[model samples]
Target chain A: MIYLELFLNFIYVGITSFGGGYAALPIIQHTVTKSNEWLTSTEFTDIVTISQMTPGPIGINAATFVGVKTAGVLGGICATLGFVFPACIIVTILAVIYAKYKKSDVMSGMLRGLRPASVGLITSAALSIITVAFFGQELLELTFASVDLIAIVIAVIAFILMKKVKFLSSPIAIIALSGVVGGAAYLIQGALV
Target chain B: MKEKRNYKILLPLFWETFKLSAFTIGGGYVIVPLMKKKFVEKLGWISEEEMLDFVSMAQSCPGAMAVNASLFVGYKMAGFIGQAVSLIATVLPCLILLTAISFVYVAFASNTVVKAVLTGMSAGVAAVMADVVIGMIGKFIKNKDVISVIIAAAAFVCVAIFKVNIIYILAVACILGFIINSRKKGAGK
Candidate 1:
């Protein structure tokens, strides 16, 4: 039943996830965390981080992780397949249609509309991620006191490293560096306490 | 002759897609240049213009860009079977690698250090996500398109503040775009 649920859930993600993988984040968050209650927001954020560090598309990686966590190997396979299925079908149909009507006004118009909307989706995704990363569990309470100063600092440092250093610009490098910094900071704090 | 040619091209097509999927990171846009080099410069399967078209289509469509591009290009070159090969090749490497990582991940799921690292990496992921938003919005602004800017802002508010479903937002935008674009076309004529 969980496997069926995972497949059905990701099928929606696959079809509606316009604008690429990042835009899919909000949809995934909404479906997995809010609707189904399969994962908490914090767990979802961890999956996003892990997905970024891994190869392949972030959306697919996330589907795999969530599937496995929710059910088992079968869930992983089902979710991954569900996530890709709609895109495969739609893109194939689009390719065939586009080949026939290469210069249709409807096509251009749809792209024009979709382009900005995708940007909006991505921006919303960024805001949601920032809120979770900076505020953590306090997101629900909406209090200034809940802000994690250390996490904010790590985020700032990571941003600077990504911008200033060429080698550390890739997401994998940034995540790795941040993990080390976070681990060290936590250890130091633990010792002090 | 066509059947023979398609059979000959399928293995190389699969290999090329596999290589691209294996080596590229960052997902969406990172694969573009590499695909351009391989498809256009190396293999001569498609022209630069066609490649650009594929990239845009890949971006605008659902799923991963790498997979979409590979599938589209494959279909263009060798039809349905080609699309299947490219799609499978594009996903195979990541599927295998991630499946392996999943096992290790579960074993170490309880490690405090691992937990701390994941927590820390979330912040970094947020920063990277921010960059993506900025980079995308910056492009539209640079072009000085007032309508696009407005649409993007409205879309942001609709989702972030109002919690409107994305499907509705897209539907509305598409209608608006269709009306505006068709009018512009008529006016131009």
Candidate 2:
């Protein structure tokens, strides 16, 4: 039953997740946290972090992670398969149809509509993650006093490194460096206490 | 003869996809330029125009853009079976790696240092997410598309503030887009 639920949930994600993997974050958050209560928001953010660190599309990594956490290996397989099932079928059909009508105005127009919307979804998703990463709560409840300065500083430094430093631009390097920084900070605090 | 030729290329196709999926660190977009080099320039399996078309189609379609692009290119080259091989090859590496990571992650979950590290990594993840948003908006600004900018802002509000379902937002945007585009066409005519 859990496997079945996971499959159904991811199938929905695969079908609706337009724009890209990042766009799927909101949908995943809706299903896993809001609807199913399978994971809390904090855990959901953790999965996003893991998905980025791992090699693959964020959507697939998330499906696998959530599936494994929910059920087991079988669940992971089912969820992964479910997530990509729609894409496989739909893209095959689209390939044929688009090939035939490569210059169709209707198709181009639809894409134009979709493009900005996808950006919007991605922006919202980014905001959601920022809220969780810094405030540890919903954005609406955010107050000046509730902000986690340590997280804010780490995020700013990571962004600067990725944007400015050529050698550390890769996401994996930034993540590893942040982990080291966090671990070192904790060790220092522990020593002092 | 064509059928036999496709069968011969299947293993190579799978291997190429597997290698690409395994090595690429970033998400779907990162693989595109590299895929072009291998599939178009080196392998000569697909033409440059065809590869660009595949990338665009992959972006427009659902699922991961990277997987979609691979499947589309495979289907173009060798048909259904080729699509299957490419899809499996593209996903298999990540599937295996994530499974392994999941097992180790459980064990590390309780470690204090690991927890602290994960906490710190979360911040980095946030910054990356912001960069993605900025990159998208920057693209719009460069294009100087006011409508797209408006739609992007509206969509942001709809989701972040109103908490509207994404499906509805997309639906509205599509309709609005179609209407505006058709009107522009009419004006041009």
For every candidate, what share of the true interface contacts is present? 0.57, 0.63
Each model's lDDT = 0.76, 0.78
Candidate 2 colliding pairs: none
Summarize candidate 2's per-residue lDDT along B1-189 as a digit string, tens digits: 344435788989999888777644445664554464468756888875466557656766788988998999778767888899998998888888788777787455556776666667667667776775786688789989999899989988998899786667877877887788899999998
Off by over 4 Å in 2: A1-79, A99-102, A144-146, A186-193, B1-86, B101-106
| Model 1 chain A: ten consecutive residues of lowest lDDT | A137-146
Off by over 4 Å in 1: A1-79, A98-102, A137-141, B1-86, B89-94, B97-107
lDDT of 1 by residue, B47-115 (tens): 754664575567657877778888888888788888999888887877776777777864455566766
Model 2 lDDT tens row, A1-193: 8988999999999998987788899999999999898888988887887776566889988898888878888888889999999999988998777656756788667667777876776677667767877887768888766676777898899989887898776555666687789667756666787
- iRMS of every model, one decimal? 5.4, 5.4
Positional deviation of A87 in candidate 2, in angstroms? 3.4
Chain B TM-score of model 2, please? 0.57
What is candidate 1's CA lDDT for residue A139?
Answer: 36
Number of the predicted model whose lDDT against the real structure is largest: 2
